[model samples]
Target: MNMLYLSVRQGSEKARIWQICDELLARNGVPPSGREVADIYVAEGGNQGTGFTQYSHWKKEYLARQEQAAPREAILLSPGTVTFRSMSVTADGTIMLPADIRRAMLLDEDGRVTVSVVDGELRVISPMVAVRQLQRRTRELVPAGTLVSDELIAERRQEAEAR
Candidate 1:
């Protein structure tokens, strides 16, 4: 048997204390204090300090996770709605992209991207989009019915004859 399972046979003590706290809050609609959990833990032959410490640590981490998940949940609940969020740039000039924006940009695979600034706004273009834009521009510049390959061949023949 795993030594970790032998600790509680169900879950960690932190989970147990959190479940207890949640149940108490649901029943009375009021949050329980550390002292109340410590008292119950002591009565059950567990350490009072352990109960309070576990509850405090679990609550802090759980709240942090919930805060981080809120944005993702909103994106899932409402599709096609724009989500404007502020992100702090790291000291190393790294700006983390959110999951929704990454998915919209089709950046599922790691590849080179062309980053440019136009009108004071940063633009990140994937290779596929960049190539399409280049193709469109080339078509506009080169008029219809102009064979670039034939022109190159004729120029090469003229150069060869002169040589």
Candidate 2:
């Protein structure tokens, strides 16, 4: 998955801050952590040099890399909720989601879903789709004795023959 950092310029409005956070959450399916948010800072004038320049420079560099590395779209999720279907882990321990799932969920290419491992169980961390389509073969191959009545089956056969 992708990691994004948002930095606000000096004198940025509170609404903008909230908006950016909301957008990030919606696009990434998770809220940025305290550390991530804290990393952002405002800059002072060039003459003062009160660490603003350094922070600004770092922000620029980080933004450039982020823009280039990140996907065009970003997925956002609600607070305290994680969506699992949108994320996966690679062999190299990099967190990511499959391309098809990303596309279907409208998540950014670089966006990631959080994952956690505990008690020998691997869990995907997200609020992905709960219902999946059953395979056609599985649906067609209903076990015997599970049917409430054979009338439906007979009707299906008749319809097939008619076609």
Candidate 3:
């Protein structure tokens, strides 16, 4: 999974960002402190200093770090969409993927999938597969929906039951 530090402007500390992060943290059942959440914003290029000059430095450092990190992309989705790609589901049910990859999936704020990226290529997956995978992986830390197709799901299910 990719780790991204998103920075937000000091003035952008509104309810939307907070709501999303809160929901995300709550879904994972790991409450993050304000400082920790602030850290992500700082990493994303947010100004952390009290004054203008210090804030400028923080922004510079954040940008530099982003440049050094792996490239990532985000996909924006309209409201009322559903389903996304599931890269890998862990034993503990934590769905892991690069933050950029998640963004590339273009899931809307409601966690609905509007797009998907597979092997660095963007394509749409069937809604059935998407939903089933999501249902199976809902307990995951960061569910990315389902990527496997119906045939694969059937085969995997059979294999699991056979064991």
Please give each candidate's TM-score: 0.39, 0.23, 0.20
lDDT of 3: 0.46
Candidate 3 per-residue lDDT, tens place, 55-122, comes to 33343344455456645322122112435655765899555445454444433223433456789975
Q: Order of candidates by TM-score, top first?
A: 1, 2, 3
Candidate 3 lands at a TM-score of 0.20
Model 1 TM-score relative to the real fold? 0.39
Sort the predicted structures by lDDT, highest score first.
Answer: 1, 3, 2
Model 2, 85-136: lDDT tens per residue?
A: 5556678987554565454643323354555789997755322221122344
| Regions more than 4 Å wrong, model 3 | 1-12, 49-163
Candidate 3: lDDT of 42?
Answer: 69
How accurate locally, in lDDT, is each candidate?
A: 0.62, 0.44, 0.46
- Model 1 is weakest, by summed lDDT over 10 consecutive residues, at 1-10
User: Could you tell me the TM-score of candidate 2?
Assistant: 0.23
Off by over 4 Å in 1: 1-91, 98-100, 103-108
Determine which window of 10 residues in candidate 3 has minimal summed lDDT: 72-81
User: For model 1, which pairs clash?
Assistant: none
lDDT of 2: 0.44
- lDDT of model 3 at position 89: 58
